[model samples]
Target: MHEAVLGIEHPGAYSSATAGTDTTVELWCNDHCDLLHVGGSEAESVVAHVEDAVGVRERIAEGDERLLITDACLKEHGDDPIEATLAEHDCLLVPPLRYAEGRKWCRVLALDAGNLTAFYRDVSAEFPVVVDSKREVASVRADRPLLTLDSALPDLSPRQHEALLTAVEMGYYRIPRDATTAEVAGKLGVERRTFEEHLRRAENKVVAGLAQYL
Candidate 1:
């Protein structure tokens, strides 16, 4: 697999107008359309414009500073071409496409080097595409690159990790409880007391590790 950072030009995108100005718009994809996380001094102006936008829909907002926006990619308004092209090539766009100087800078996870190359060719043909970084995904060193629970709590013993994951999947942590400790224990072929022991120990480690940050 390959991971590459790309900068795509978004001409006439609502983001383009706000770029390198006062407002900063960071975007990611939902089921459909781009989700915008907005901030900066001119945030209110960006919200006002997107609220009335024909192809854009504003879902909810904490304030003008943070909002969820959906771009319908309507043809008439020159919606971004980068997304659709990436989709066709089976490349995944990493979250938070940042706007700066009229470009949408984002990271893409390509299934293979060929896919990344193909995406580059297809996208660069229409708009300027800058390859900021390119490398084998395994070559990238990050403290918690995959962002899994295990990465967050590296001190967890193997048994504790398994118990915790099973507990979560069986809804042992859910409100009103979808599953019980006994049921979880049976699934893991352990005594209910044993499962509880592992779970409690794991939970304590997690809470203690997180509490300092809070």
Candidate 2:
């Protein structure tokens, strides 16, 4: 087994060098600006190690770290299968992990009831990021039209396929939102948390797919 490493990591440098079997789990607790960046890599017990470190992260954040997870987002994604899977190892679920040129998103996770709860999920494709020596946040806003569903929609996993369509049908993204998380959760016959995870993973995949066009 590889030796375990835990640290606050940025993938920009590591992306090109990362190899398969190089298991690095990056975790952030709370939303907005994540004060705590908990991660572990190169360990057989990565999940367990992260769980333990997250406690310290939580404690530290209690003092120096600041970010408040929204209850609505928690209710949206806390009970996903991934959440349960990580919870078994004492790892809380965080927001979707993504890497690309212009977009940035932030999400949060925490340990509660010995279970990992996730919340404060946000997605920003045109997020501002410091670029080059000039230190200007890059803006790649496409006031362009939404691409046709045929070309833009990603190849979905069975579960993602269901979740995205469900969100649309329920009007979760519609103006004046027609369905709340709880209502959509019921319609999908999933716990409010489970549905949220599904939705999160689904959205991540879609965004990741679209990012290829950049």
Candidate 3:
């Protein structure tokens, strides 16, 4: 099996709310409605923008999150490229598609690398797309237990995962600290401040996820 994280420059009401802001939105949708978890300092403004977006039948806000009953599923929009391409390629999207900084991030699984590649190509034709990560995984066995590292780990954004991996590879966490934040940031082609932010978030997620075991 093959899995990948794809970042797509899709234009939508949620994307518009996240553009030029630190806000992040995670969405789960069906045929009728969408549930969104909004996070960041600007979540209130983000929810307000979503309320005014076309096709929203009704909205309920609870703290920083929102439940939206919509006329149509966002994925089923006439012009959306994801849902159709996914079906054509026989790929599956892992839920909670993420939106941040005007891009939609999706985690997709495919039977093989070829199908994943074709799916990426088709989606890229419609919108700017970036393959953030890709890997081949062992095929699942019917008798095997469900609990695993992948399931236990928290889902980190592509940038956060990249930042954490880069830091580790550069020996940022070594006893002697072979690399500094500036060095790791330079390696990743990002500002030091931005790199630090991603690394911190990644660390927090990982630590929090493992706290119970510790």
- Global lDDT of model 2: 0.39
Please provide, for model 3 over 99-126, each residue's C-alpha lDDT reduced to its tens digit, 9 standing for 90 to 100.
Answer: 8878888889898889999999988988
**lDDT by residue (tens digit), candidate 2, 74-120:** 22323333333444545432233322121222222333422212211
Off by over 4 Å in 3: 54-72, 75-79, 141-204
Name the regions of candidate 2 deviating beyond 4 angstroms: 1-153
The lDDT per prediction is 0.69, 0.39, 0.79
Better of 2 and 3 by TM-score: 3
For TM-score, the strongest prediction is 3
lDDT of 1 by residue, 1-214 (tens): 7878777786755556575554556666554566776654466676566555534566565533566656553234455568788898999987656664566676788878999899889888988877767777654348646443332442454467779999999898899899999999999999999889778867876897777767
Go through the candidates in order and give the clash count of each: 0, 3, 0
- Give per-model TM-scores: 0.52, 0.30, 0.67
TM-score for model 2?
Answer: 0.30
For residue 158, what is the lDDT in candidate 2? 42
Model 2 clashes, total count? 3
Best model number under lDDT: 3
